[model samples]
Each structure stands twice: as C-alpha cells, then as structure tokens.
Target: MICYFSGTGNSMWVAQTVSERFRDNRLTDMADAVVSSNNLNFSLTEDERLGFVFPVHSWGIPWIVRKFINRMTIDNYSNQLIYCILTCGDDSGLTNKMLLKLFRRKGWQCRHIYSVQMPNTYVVFPGFDADPAELEQKKTAEAVPTLEKIMAAIVSDSPIDCYLQKGQQFLKSRIIYPLFCRFAMSSKPFRTTDKCIGCGVCVKNCPTHNIRLENGRPVWANNCTQCLSCLHRCPQTAIEYGKESIGKGRYYYGKRKDSQQ
Candidate 1:
C-alpha cells in the first residue's frame, strides 16, 4: 500500500511512480484519507510493503502528516517492509529522521528513506519566483530519470543512508516543534478577495477541507494543511496569503477540471 500527501502534485507524482513498480498496489490521497479518517480497509500481510510519500516543511514533516502517522493503527504486520520518500524544494535536512522516529513509535521497521528535490512551492520566502516553462522542463527532466533509479533501488532492496538521523532527533526534541507551532503556525492565513468566482475549487481541493464557501467566498478555517492548493488553483487570481503573493506564479497539475458545466 502506498499512501501519499502531495501539496502541488510533486509528491503525488513520486507516489504514482513508486506504486507503478509494484503489484496489487493501492494509492490513497492523504487528503481524502484524512477526510475519511484513514479508514483504508487493507490488511498488511507478511509479504506486503507499506510506503509513504509527502513533502517536507520546516525541515520536518508537515504537521498533518505527522498526525496521520501517529494516529494510524497497524498490528500484526511486523514482516512488512516500510519505506518513505520525501520531496523537497531544497535540503530536506532533518525531516527523514523525524519520520523514522514516528514510524518506530508505530512499531514499523523502516527499510529506507529517501529525498528528492522538486520545485520550491513554499512562497513564504522573499522575492520567490520561477519561470513556469523552465521549472516544468527541469522538473520533468530530473524526475523521470531519478524516479526510475529509485524504483530500481526499491526493487533490488538497496540500502540507504540514514542521512538526517541526528538532525531529525534534534529537531523533534521538546523545544523546536513546540516553538514553531506557537509562533509560525499561529500566524494569520491568507485572505480571499471578492473576485472569487464561487467555484468551490478551493473547498473541494483543500486536503484538510479547511476552506468553506461563505457569502460566495472561500473562508479558511484553522485546520488548513497550508498546501497552497486553494491559492494556486483560483482562476480569478484572487487568493493572497501574505500581502498578495506578488510575482509568484501559480501551478496546477493534470487537466483543470471544468467546473462551469
């Protein structure tokens, strides 16, 4: 089984590639899974493997991903091989190690954890912008060959270095995440404008279902995943996180679903 959480389709692509290499595969979106409370009805037998793919945030796993892993209940699956793939824009740093600890607490043994560089979608940085055409080209060029190699490695049961093991330990300790939660996550979310077309694309696409239509505009509730799916997909270009995401290009994966019909 492969369970993945993707913010902007980068991690989704990685999850899809990994699943394609295996038989009897099951792919579940972390967003939908969370909405359904992860009631995925699959039994992990001895010969099976469990894989998780997601993006890295704040030099660690996203808060929702961590919650999902902690809340999951798996029993009688000691023989299953576990692997994780983290997609990041830059250095993953300590994220992989934090994941290992979480998995360990859940009684799962991890065989390998790996990281891949995707386009930096976290727009919080100052003056963040990328050429869409070039970004897409680079992403495709890098992903295709890298994913092929990763799939080959998984098939061959190759070994991987616990790259961020120590760093993860330090980050996950008492001080770091708590301070982050209090300060960083507590900041106000982006606001939507009257130009919103009442399309409900943001509502439907929000992984945590945190946005709801009120008076024909999207209102973000506190349970946001901060994935930017809603902000990126707004056709009117009306969504703004902090002071209007000036000069940041929006991205959407696959074909845009025609909501007008």
Candidate 2:
C-alpha cells in the first residue's frame, strides 16, 4: 500500500505516479482517511508492502501526519519493509531523521526514506510565488531522473540510506520543528473575503474537516494543520490568512492547464 497526504497535489503526484508502476499496490490518502476517522489505526497484514508519502512541513512532518502515525495500530509490522517518501520544494531539513525517530517511538521499524523535490506550496504568506518558469523547468528536469531512481529502489526493495547532515538535521528537526508547532499552526487568521460565492470547495477539500461554511463564506476551526488546502483551492481565490495573503498568487499543483479552474 502506498498512502499519501497532499494539500496541493505534490505528494499526491508522487503517490499516484508510484501506484501506476505498481499496479497491484494500494494507493491510500491519509487526508481522506482522517476526514473519515480521527484515530487512524489500520489492520493491514505485515506481509504486504507499505509505503507513506507526504509533504514536509516546517522542516518536519506535517502535524496531522505525525498524529495519524502516532495513533495508528497496525496488526504486525515485522514483515513489512515500511518506507517513506517526503515531498518538498527544496531541502527536507532532516525531516527524514525526525520521522524515523517518531516511528521508532511508535515501535515501527522504517527501513528507507526518500525525498522528492516538488513544486513549493507554502504561498499563504506574503513574498512568495510559484516557482518561476525557468526554476520550475529546472526542478521538473531534475525530478524525472530522481523519481526514476526512487522507483527502482522501491521496486528492488533496496534499503537506501539518506544523506544525513547532522548539524543541519539537528537544527531543523529539533529547533525549527518545535517552533513551527508553537507558532505556525494557528488558524485564527483564516477567513474568506467578500468574493466568496457560498461554494463549499474549501470545506469539502479540507483534510482535517477544519473548515465550514457560515453565511456563505468559509470559517476555520482551531484544529487546522496549516495545510493551506482551503486557501489554494478556493476557485475565487477568496480565502485569506490575515492581511498579508490578500493579493498573493494562488497556485495549485497544475494550475496552468486546468481550464476548469
């Protein structure tokens, strides 16, 4: 099984791509499961292959993904070569190391971790934009060979270790992750502008079910994981997080060719 959690489709693209190669492999979405059940305990057999793919948040795993893994109860894990794939715009900053630590704490032995560089989605704040054309061209050009290598490694069940820069890893996983947990997950600043058209796309798409419509606009509950799904998927670009996000560009994973948007 290859499970994923994606806010802006970067991780989903990775999960879907891998699923296509492994036709019998199951493709599960952590977000969809969380929306259906708060406590994410699964009963998959140990003999089956298991994979997790998700975006790195604030130099660590997304809070919801961490929570999901923390609460899960698998039947048996010894026979499984559990693997992880982290999607990011640039570097993961030791997200791999921190996740392994968390898995250890949960008594799950993860054997491999891979990083996939995808388009950045942290645009809810000011002074950020989608990767410019040339930069995006460069990233995609690089991702092809990288994804191929990852596919081969997974297919061969190779236990590939990662490049662990201890200093940077310590800083990001220890220092940055906690700070982000303290300061970055707040949902108080989320609100929809007047352009909101009573459409419930944000409410429907929120993986945490933290958004709902009130008086024809989306209102955020405090349980938000800062996934930015509501902000990016709003058809009108109607959602804003405080004043800084008012005029920033809204980017979906493939907004360029989606005429439906």
Candidate 3:
C-alpha cells in the first residue's frame, strides 16, 4: 500500500506513478484517512509492501501526515519492508530521520528512504517562490530518471537511503523545523482578494477540512497545515498568504501541463 498526503499534486503524482508500477497496490490519501475513521485501518497481504509518500513541509513531515500516523491502526504482524518517498522543493534536511522515529514507535522498520526534488511550492515566506518555467520544466524532466531508479531498487528490494539534496541535518531539522512547526502554521495569514468568486475550491481542497465558505467568502480555521493548496489551487488566483505572496506565482502541477512531461 502507498499512503500519501499531497497538497498540490506533486506527491500525488509520484504516488500514482509508483502505484502503477506494481500490481494490487492500494493508494490511500493520508489527508482523507485522518478525517474518515473507516479509512485508517489497514491489513496488508503477505506479499504487500508498505510505502509512505509525502511532501516535505518546513523541512519536516507535514502535520497532517503525522496526525494520520498517530491515529491509524495497522493490523500486520511480521516485519515487512517499508519505504518512503519524500517529495521536496529543494533540500529535505533530516526529515527522513524524523520519519524513522515515527515508524520506530510502531515497531516497524523503515528499510529504504528517498527524496526527490520537485518544483518549489512553498511561497508563504520571503525569498521563496515557485520555480521559473524553465527550472520547473527541468525538475520535472529530471525526476523521471530518479523515480525510475527508485522503482528499480524497490523492485529488487535493495536497501537504498539516497536522500539527495538533504541540507544541514542538525540545523534545519533539529533546530529550525521545530520552530517552524510551532509558529509558522497559522491560518490567520490567509485571505481572499477581490478575485475570489466563492467557487468552494479552497473549501473542498483543504486537507484538514479547515476551510469553510461563509457569505461568499472562504473562512480559515486555526488548524491549517500550511500546505499551500488553497493558495495554489485557487482558479481565480484569489487566495494569498499575507503580504509575502502578493506577487508570487502559484503552482499546483496540473496548472502547468508540462510538469507531466
């Protein structure tokens, strides 16, 4: 089974590609699993493999993914080969190390871990924006070879721990990541501009169900994960994350069809 949480379709596309390479691989959305109780339990077959695919948030796992792991119950006995495919804009820091502890608590050994750099999507901060059209196209094209290599290793059951572009393990993950989780996840910064048509896209796409439409406007709850889905997926380019995202570009993968190239 490949369980994943994707805000803008980068991780989802990776998960779908990997799932298609194998037979009878179940795809579970971590966001939906956390909200729906019935989707949390899983019993993997003897031959089945387990995988976690998600985007790195603030150089760590997204809070929504952590929430799902904390709540879900997996009813399998033996130590099966578990792997993770992390999607990131640039470097992932020690996000893989953090994930290792999560599976350790459950007595599951995470055998292989890998990170792939996709287009940049986090734009709530200064000096961070989506990749340019050329760079975005480059990353998308480059990911195909990396993914193929990862799939080859998985097929052979090779123990690979290639976390490419993992920068500053101690400083980024151990120090900065915790602070980011504590103070950077506020939903109060989000607001719709005059371009908003109240189409309910943001309401429906929010992973945590933390958005609702009221009086033809989207209202945000305090439980946002800062996934940037609402900001990027807005059809009318309505959502903004404070002053930082005023003139920044929006990206949701499908918005650029060349991403699939």
For all candidates in order, the CA lDDT equals 0.71, 0.78, 0.86
- lDDT of each residue in 1-261, candidate 2, tens digit only: 887898877787778888887674677677667657765666666567678889888778898788777777776667576888888877788787788888888787876798877777787656765677567657666777787788788778886654323357777778978998889899998877789898999998888888888877788888888888888888988888888677666666666558657
> 118-222, model 1: which lDDT tens digit per residue?
776776546655336576557656867776766667767895452323344465544565565556653265777678788898888788878888988888777
> Order of candidates by TM-score, top first?
3, 2, 1
Task: Report the error of model 1 at residue 153, Å.
Answer: 1.2
Which lDDT tens digits does candidate 3 get at residues 180-227?
899999999999999999999999998879899999999999878888
Q: Point out where model 2 deviates above 4 Å.
A: 125-127, 161-167
After superposition, candidate 1 runs with Cα above 4 Å error:
38-42, 130-132, 161-179, 254-261
The CA lDDT at 134 in model 1 is: 73
Which ten contiguous residues of candidate 2 have the minimum total lDDT?
A: 159-168
Instruction: Name the candidate, 2 or 3, with the larger TM-score value.
Output: 3
Off by over 4 Å in 3: 258-261
User: Judged by TM-score relative to the true structure, which candidate is superior, 1 or 3?
Assistant: 3
